[model samples]
Target: MNAGPSTAAGSAELRGEPPLVVDLDGTLCYSDTLWEALLLFLKHHFWQAWRLPLWLLLGKAGFKAALAGRIALDPGALPYDQTLQRELEHQRAQGRRLVLATGADQRWAERLAAHLGPFEQVLASAGGVNLTSRAKADALVRLYGAHGYDYIGNSRADLAVWQSSRHAYSVTRKPFRLADGRHTEHIGSVRPQPLAALWRAMRPRQWLKNLLVFVPMLAGHALNAGALAQSLLAFAAFSLCASSAYLLNDALDAHDDRRHPDKRRRPLAAGTLPLPLALAASPLLALGAFTLCALFDPLLLAVVGIYLAATLAYSLRLKRMLMIDIVTLALLYTVRILGGCAATLIAPSFWLLAFSFFVFLSLALLKRYSELFNLHSRGQDKSSGRGYTVADKAPISIMGINSAFLSVLIFMLYFNSQTVLTMYRHPYFLLGIVPLLVFWLGRLWTLAFSGQVNEDPVLYVSRDKVSLTVLALCFGLALAAT
Candidate 1:
């Protein structure tokens, strides 16, 4: 909703007019407190989620009250409709009384009213009564008579109340037309780019990590047509499952993401992608992933299932644990290589697993180091959701650098192994990759120290020219050795 002040002037014409009534969810605020509270509850109490159905059996009002009592959503951090808020403030400045009527819990309604305005009264669901639709219309009519006050709303449920109001002002995607010939005007419209927002929410750029699923086939020199085809299928399945996990993670973190400087612009956190739509899309993506995996092989499906499970565990609980988060991230990366081995029917190499684990661990720690470095630069001591502080940044960098060198040593040892002698005609060419790895890792750490890397290192590598050059040279060296 992005209407300008000129649109608000229309309401000024009604001098000494009746009090203005405003809807809460989707009208005054860009998000629904009820849905946000429910998500927060599920996020924190996932182990006790059975309580949700039992609470809902208490009815909508009772369910909302129960959630409100359990979780306290921060009112100040909510994404309010700024344009509509300006209009409300203008009306208030004009001395017109304002009433906040919402289907959200009474506590949330009063909290928002106190936080954002001069509402004379707050009417919301309470004491087992869900004050919405017809009930809200009746209550307003009882207090101010039919057609005595103007109304502003943004959903079909508010149509009943609009029918009983003096005038209708809408902020929905489409304007409302009353059949009773009452005046109606569109104040604003929530015209989001649904397809673009959905695509962004999927985080397709992060799918680059799924390319690791091809490593096993490439490493074992299994580039036959069938092996290539199976590996491609495995990559697709992993990408889809990864996307599903990303969506769920974003939905769960939307509240806290809104407080982070960079993450706040994400689709779910910024309200560009609706929470309900994101939640619905996540399971469908996972189902599609499993279907693809099944078409390849049951073994491949089992591997993808484990990856999904680990990802869900990380998103749900492991991400907040101290060093466990980084370890989990590294293992998730290694799982992609394992998936490739399953797809290509290749025996996994101990050397490949060891090298990948340490390299990815280094990358994961680099990511956390960047985050904490940024926080420290901002004069903040602690990360929002993770278990890290500014003081941990130095040690994190040291650990990450050591891990990178350890991966290099593993790669050197793998070159000396019989496996490398049988696979590569000129095994010495592979040693050139070591210096490139060292240079890239050193430069990455330097960039992190200088605050040049501010996001996922994998993502940053995709865009960094130096990193890309290093990767291209590494691939060239491997091809030469083969």
Candidate 2:
């Protein structure tokens, strides 16, 4: 413990000043412990989630204590409001008593206090009592007498406490009106617009992957306006569903993401985006996706249901498994093509499925390899939330390289099939795409090996000049064949 300012206690004795009490969630800490603990509980003990309502029946305090007892959160890893912390330290240096008063469970309060404080006292929820709002105000009034202490807090729940305190300080973006007609000091400026943060969290760039939904329509030569419109609708639906999955994945991974070099900047992980909003938006987005699917063919909706289920499974458990995670990722990409076929009422060709599977499989492996490579570069042996160690890098690269070549071979066989003759006016023009595919895949792996590829390979390809150029060339070749 940092016993700040050796003469602080003696100094406070000379001056009779009110103790400074600070809120925990959203005031001193950028995150809510309850939400973080709950998400982690669900992530690790999903089966026991049925007990949540039962626990809640024990009242808010019991529910919080139950969760704290089950999972141990690292207080040091939490995102704290640095500005507020600095102000608290300054006050402590001035010999003002600092109190940590929060609605969080006593366990978390004590842990956080020990990790980052010279707090004179810790007040929090305990013994089946939830210390918040009116209860918190009443307790403080009883302990320090009404208007005898200064308080710093955030959120509407703090209003009652502010009314009971002598001075009010806030960390919230919006100004609050104190019922007691006292001034509330704003500590920091408002964060970036919620819409901007939401947009980033939605990750519209990844929607590029949803473009695969148009592949079946293009391959089947269903260029009619009606077919094109349906494919576009399928694209929109899949994009929304994919965003929903991304939100859920980010929420579950927020803790682990903080340990990552790049992912730590994600909205939820960085605390720029509120966890409750992310959790709420996730299901709403899924509902909107399903609503869009309902406007299309029934089969398309069924395909989307499968896609959502698979994505949920992948986010929940499959992603933590070794090889299974990679295969599941490839299957998700193939599902987009299936959605296209269902939307346009086109039968999927065996060759199309075979080529897509191997191609996406290779890309999936590349994604994992990139993550492992980053970890290895940092001298870490194991990935934070993954099953792979640095030692698996070589085998993953070999398998990925082979999968890429196998996909090329599948495309070659596809060019020779009678199906190719029916769709192309000049079938031999399609052969030009083979070398382009090989070069693109080889270049991607080379970058991964050299540590240039630091994110998902599919997302990387969207921004990669060389890969985009290769894609354009392949498209031109296909257009000539058509």
Candidate 3:
């Protein structure tokens, strides 16, 4: 977030008239908590309900619009300690001016700014300016003159505004989970105890990813009749099944996660979620999911078995292999799509699967890249496979390359396919790749580079702007072709 004005060297007279410039992220709203909630939201609502290509078009602006309606983003999103509240109040009681400044976009800044009772104005980056430290420093200098008022912050980056301010204060308590790699927010206590914590632990984002099963059937309406019913059943079954896996994974990872800065706040690691309860909950959820599948389609039950096995393998073994772990994740997603096709007796084009894998792999690689950056900053070795360690940067980059190419290759092949030709009703629909390519290559990689990329590909796309535009254009073209 933008630091307040720097202090002048000589005297109080030299220090420009300082309005209170408050940082948005740590000072006002806790980023860690919001992100966790956002992750949950993406999994449950956006991911499953929105088509990937269309979701890609929603971008951050759209997502922020979504958040305004769905979340209580005002001052309530920022649950702060009593001590901080008094400190802010003390500052407010003073004649000092108040302005909310942050590295986050104007939307978030405004959302947060509206709730800060005393702030005079909110200054934030529009497209990209407000997201990094240097920019924040520049903003502080531009907005608040030399030697301004005392500044309050939480992270090392705040050291910039901290050092420059006449006086500074830092908060030690953080309200985010340890496993959460977002370092902008400090690790803090979870408000709710074991029960609420367990509910949160069941990740809804994977449920959105599970919607992959529906894509093929939607793409091919001939399989729509009976397959639609079966697909809906699979979706329900997998949602419960994935929740079970999340509970089990959190329990197993509690030991390791406790060591993590963010994961430590997780229910099990924090001692809020009891181990026995989680142990009981895991298999029971799984069994319930499986039972539902059994009543619907044996083939679906088998697919869920594979999903369970793969996830178990991931929890038990695969997560340690770095590149292999990512590959496994991609395959698992592909299998979900393939499994649906099998259950419905519909054949997915080989080219389609190829394209899907590559596209997802690209996003998976971006997640790894972000992980590597975070791990390296923490002075951890990247060689460990569970989370991308900094050591294997080459493979991650190479995997991204392959994944991008695969997306192009798949689309190109799809262009030649008779199914696409028949459905599209126009040879020109093949040109849809122009926007798709630009959207994918530009938008996703930018997020990865910016360290804003989400672990789930669908999540990342849903929050990107340019990608969404291209996606919309492509869809409009497809409609025209049809």
Candidate 2 deviant stretches above 4 angstroms: 1-16
lDDT values, one for every candidate: 0.88, 0.89, 0.63
What tens digits encode model 3's per-residue C-alpha lDDT throughout 1-482? Answer: 12222223222332234555566554454333234334334433543545434533666444444553454433442334444445455555554566666655566567666665667777665642434355665567666654465555656666666555545544444422222232222322223455786787776655777888887776665444687887878788778888888887776555456566666676665655555677688899999988987876787888889999998878766777757888887888888887777667678887778888887787777767776766767788843327554667667877786778768877877877787766767668658655578566756766666666644556656666766777677757756666
Cα displacement (Å) at residue 367, model 1: 0.5
Clashes of 1: 0
Number of clashing pairs per prediction, in order: 0, 0, 23
lDDT order, best first, reads 2, 1, 3
Report lDDT (Cα) of residue 239, candidate 3: 83
The positional error of residue 23 in candidate 1, measured at the CA in angstroms, is 1.0
**Candidate 3: misplaced stretches above 4 Å?**
1-193, 223-225, 383-388, 455-457, 465-476
lDDT of 2 at 272: 80
Per-prediction TM-score, please?
0.96, 0.95, 0.57
Residue 217 displacement in candidate 2 (angstroms): 1.4
Off by over 4 Å in 1: 1-15, 181-184
On TM-score, who's better, 1 or 3? 1
Displacement of the residue 128 alpha carbon in candidate 2, Å: 1.3
What digit string (tens of lDDT, one per residue) describes model 2 on residues 304-363? 999999999999999999999999999999999999999999999999999999999999
lDDT of 2: 0.89
